[model samples]
Target: MNRTPESLTAALDAAMATLDEAVAGGKARLTPEEIGHITYIGKGIALIDGLPGVRSEELLMLGDGVQGLVFNIDPEQVGVILLGDYGALGAGDLVRRSGEVLAVPVGEDLLGRVVDPLGRPRDSRGEPVCHERLPVERPAAEVMDRAPVTVPLATGIKVIDALIPIGRGQRELILGDRQTGKSAIAIDTIVNQRGKDVVCIYCAIGQRSSSIARVIEQLQRHGALDYTLVVVAEGDDPPGLQYIAPYAATSMGEFFMEQGRDVLVVYDDLTQHARAYRELSLLLRRPPGREAFPGDIFYLHSRLLERSTHLRPERGGGSLTALPIIETEAQNLSAYIPTNLISITDGQIYLSPQLFQKGLLPPVEVGKSVSRVGGKTQLPAYRAVASDLKLSYAQFEELEIFSRFGTRLDDETRRTLERGRKVRGILKQPQLSPLSPAEQVMVLYAVTQGLFDAVPEPELSQAEAAVVAALGILPDIVRTIEQGETLKPEALEALLAAARKAVSPLLGPEKVADDH
Candidate 1:
């Protein structure tokens, strides 16, 4: 066992040969990972030094599995928006680059499920079965890849569908003061998509849990949850989550849109989303502009909304329609954020607090609400019946205002005011009750033709309900209307006949005598 110089040399040479063989075989390769340390931590954000190779919006892992996004990358350090509970993280904690941008799970499994911005299930439904993951921030479809929005997206609300129509692939703004039925309109639209083969995604950013629960309950009650996806970012969630919520939800919708399916995404209100981004930007020391918002606030929403468009046939011919809700301060439409959104979207559906106060449900202000592109997408039947409806209603509004001064002296003006009241009554709809296209056409035809003018104002609702209920006997006429055909003379006669019969019993003797 005594070692000699020659024997030691022989053993050392053999060990060197083995090491070279392992290296040449690629079995001993070295893997270098970049790790950094948090230099400072702020509310929902952290400044990290080192890891100079991190990319903007890249996902990073902090201490104890907390995730962060690289927001501001400078020579000295990078600002990260924390995505999880950062309470466990402190300055000097370890940070590792995930080397990937933030992505969310997207697939059929998301239907009927409630998830967070990170695609984590919050509905206690266990892990979602997602077969694919898409980056939260994706470039929109090219201009050539988009198609004109010719198909109508019916909200089943008589007023919206007949007057302020929404088309597939349109970006429609729903804005109003608080407690003015803005959310009600959006939910009704979602519920209306129950049998329409449209996939709906309701992204609630910075909303109360109870409010979100009520929405879910309504969707479930109407069986809309079957094809709907609820993506929630509660008010208590980190600002980062709220900021990325709509993008993640849009990514989820894009999956279906690319599959030749129509998708509807509702950003319950972008006010909070903008606020969340503002908070993050200020904390990260980004330059602020008007209203203390970052300069890119316009781009922030534009890019998100631009993702919704109708695709060309070669690109699967699908579409993503957006209903972005915004709350106004004291009904101010010219405010900074409201004006920006008004300029971005295709049209605005301005709800009126005055109308709401008057017990007009949905409370959509006809004068302020408009659909820029939806006019081209309305049904032929609507054009035949409601073409002059909007103009007449606007005139009625003007005349009614003047009449309030007790200055009305003309017979025609009095009749116009009376008709306007009846028109408003017909447009008033209950929550969760969406009308069929044929039914909407039926009721619209009745009012536009002055059939409801004979019924007393209080009896208008019953008369309209009776007209809708009596539609079953006019199956052929309903079919014709729903086929998007113009209402022929015979069809109009049939509609009027059925409507008159249904409304006659409800009319009082005084109303009947006045009509005669």
Candidate 2:
């Protein structure tokens, strides 16, 4: 027999297989493990000197079960950002690769539970019952896989729904100075999602414990906890945890979105998220740019926000709507981070500190805020009621500013100012009390139709409440409006009649008859 190389190689393989089988019953197989040692330790990061094959963003285990992320891979040393307590870790500590990237538990079980960025239960409840895990970083859906945003995500805030509307799958930025009701809008939006079949995830990054508790309590009190998930990375958490919090929350929401469910993920102020990243990047020796932020700062948010979109019917027909909040300083929208976010989002809802001081609960500056896609998604009834509303409101604002100089005005301008005041009054809603679409339309219709012009400005809230209460009697009209249909002439008349009857006592017969 001619001993060919192929036959010889096959014989050698067979001998090795027989030897392995012979020892399988009595001996265990040994596998190679790559271990590195921390060469230096910083506040929330460590430098490792081994693990030549370690991948960037891969999870690493350090002393005492502390986890770290491979933030930078260098020829001589690797930079790892510690995700947990680093006090127990020091130089020369052993580090082991997890052989996987950073991931968090995701499933239906996570809903209604308060958890940290790592998906560990933070509530009194036991461990989360999730059966699957997903990586914290995911590529966004391709354009071909996304559908046009056609459905409205009604926030139930009259000003938002009437002027600065939000559409499902749209990335709408909520930006304002501190204490300007930025988070309030997001929370109210979540509260409004109740019974709308929309799953909400609120990611609190670098917020105070008391603030987080307050938010959770609000959700519970409103029964929104049943459909909402809270992901918290408190202000004192490690910078690494804060940096990854929103991404982890987004992954959790993506799980539900893939299941054909509409999901809303609110990043409560990414300013801290950016600051956390800046800290980590500076520690990792990455070069900083304007505002001392890493050059990839814009890319960081663009990538995360790009993941939110409406998937095609074939892909799931689900949508992931993002309401990422950003905090500004001294009402400066031109700041570095604010500008980046404003350019990235489909539109922005600018909350004015000035308006907030004036006791506007939402403080949404309509002139500065806009909705690029929501107009197409708004209901036909809303279109009819607010077609000229925004323009008229803008005009009133400019005129009011001029009138502040004590200039004498004509009857027409005075009437416009009065109507505008009524409009503003009707838009002022109390916190935690979100209106339904039907109720919003009713009150908005009354204001836009000049029915509220005669009503006393001091009694606007009471009159608006009366109109909302009267909606119960016009169930057919309510149903029609909620169904997104164009309001019929008779339905409009019926709504007008109900509004007059509801506010007659407050307005008096003469005031109510003035409308005719």
Candidate 3:
């Protein structure tokens, strides 16, 4: 029952069939000269996303490496989407490997600035004036026959030290909900690593501009700007760009890592990065999963983060530590993405907004957060103090919960409760101040040893923070304690004496500010 069209329709129909076959399956080998110069326009190489579309019937080179191909139709003229290595091409790019895939470069310039997936400067600073760029997803550092994580990675915070301490080449995930200081924890870690011979990369994906800016400012304030590299893929970036952001940052981190140097990369939050992929998938007509995210979402994140690792002993003894943050909606740790991260990391620092509001800056839930890798790399001093740290914390939690029942206990029970209360106070600090590792150990030991029992139950919080502040512990303290060294009992006692002496005056009745 099909009606025949006029003479012109016959020729058009014949051409369309040829176009379809060539676009979908025909072999089209571009000459070496046609690589990097291809036009980024969709007409040249149509990308319809998930759905297959019209085929390219013919190809011609514009001589400057620019490839002009005839497609049955253009797919909305969207800009080119890089699928893979850009380094193989140069300014006079050719199309020999037509889809070699444009990628961002990794190098020394990445420290302390925000960048996009394409490795272009997303901070509006123009293309990074860099010495070089590298492809984003490279291989993992050598596996077995590898050196252990001997050095520590300090975050300048007390709780992280006394518990959940990080080590070089560790893959630690920072999991939390919004406004719980996830990024803050990451930045603090980077800033504190300033002089530790570690190169830092901060990759920001789908974050607000203001928030990204604040990250840079924090680095600058801590004098970590020069040594830190920033890679940003903000919320305004195109879907394609956002999808590639973390890989670009990884590439930058790998540069330092390969040279036998320590490298730390923080993918500020992978949730948005995954969202960007889902958007791209929908646009390309790919199937959606439960969250409308691509089915390979887990693989995508794993591959990016897996690139960070400790190398084999024969591989220059290099390492890449990753701190990939995940923001769970409504603290839904059971969600696919959250669970995926919780499993991938060696450990997690579970930040809670509820605790932060109650004056826990890092707000780490010591019970929920743990390093599965054990204290393999903690400084000896840190190890010693941390052994009893958790026990003390558990006691504090149990006693506090029991006190809530209002069943008055014996005098000894009340004293134990008061001591536990003081320990919690010592760990609390203002919004940004991070402690020295020494201070962390001292506070941990003091609280666990029942040294703070006399500080008064109500003033525990402020009194706890003062012990370190007055002694000027931190920055230098954690390092000395963790340097694979030892200390005599006398020396240890001397240090504690100094911290106690510093806290005594501030623990008086008129020292409300010290306790607060």
- The lowest-lDDT stretch of 10 consecutive residues in candidate 1 is 507-516
The weakest ten consecutive residues by lDDT in model 2 span 507-516
TM-score (C-alpha) between model 2 and the true structure? 0.94
Q: What are the per-residue Cα lDDT tens digits for candidate 1 across 450-471? A: 8898787787888888999989
lDDT of 1 at 295: 92
Which digits, one per residue and each the tens of the lDDT, describe model 2 over residues 163-258?
A: 988999999999988998989999999999999999999999999999999999999999999999999999999999999999999999999999
1-516 per-residue lDDT for model 3 (tens digits): 665677569878889999998898967878433222433332113232211222332333333443333322345522233322222323333333333334456666565565666565656566666776565556665457466776778887877766788888888888888888888888878878866788888888888999888888888887887888887767875655567778877877777887788888898789888887776667545679977877788888878777877776577778889999989888788999988788777888898778888876668877788876537777688666567776768777888888899897999888777776666676665655666667677777667665576676566666566766654544344456756666557656766676666567646655534444
Candidate 2 lDDT for residue 229? 95
Better structure of 1 and 3 per lDDT: 1
lDDT of 3 at 342: 80
Give the poorly placed runs of model 1, Cα more than 4 Å off: 1-26, 508-516
TM-score of 1: 0.95
Count clashing residue pairs per candidate.
0, 0, 36
Q: What is the TM-score of each candidate against the true structure?
A: 0.95, 0.94, 0.78
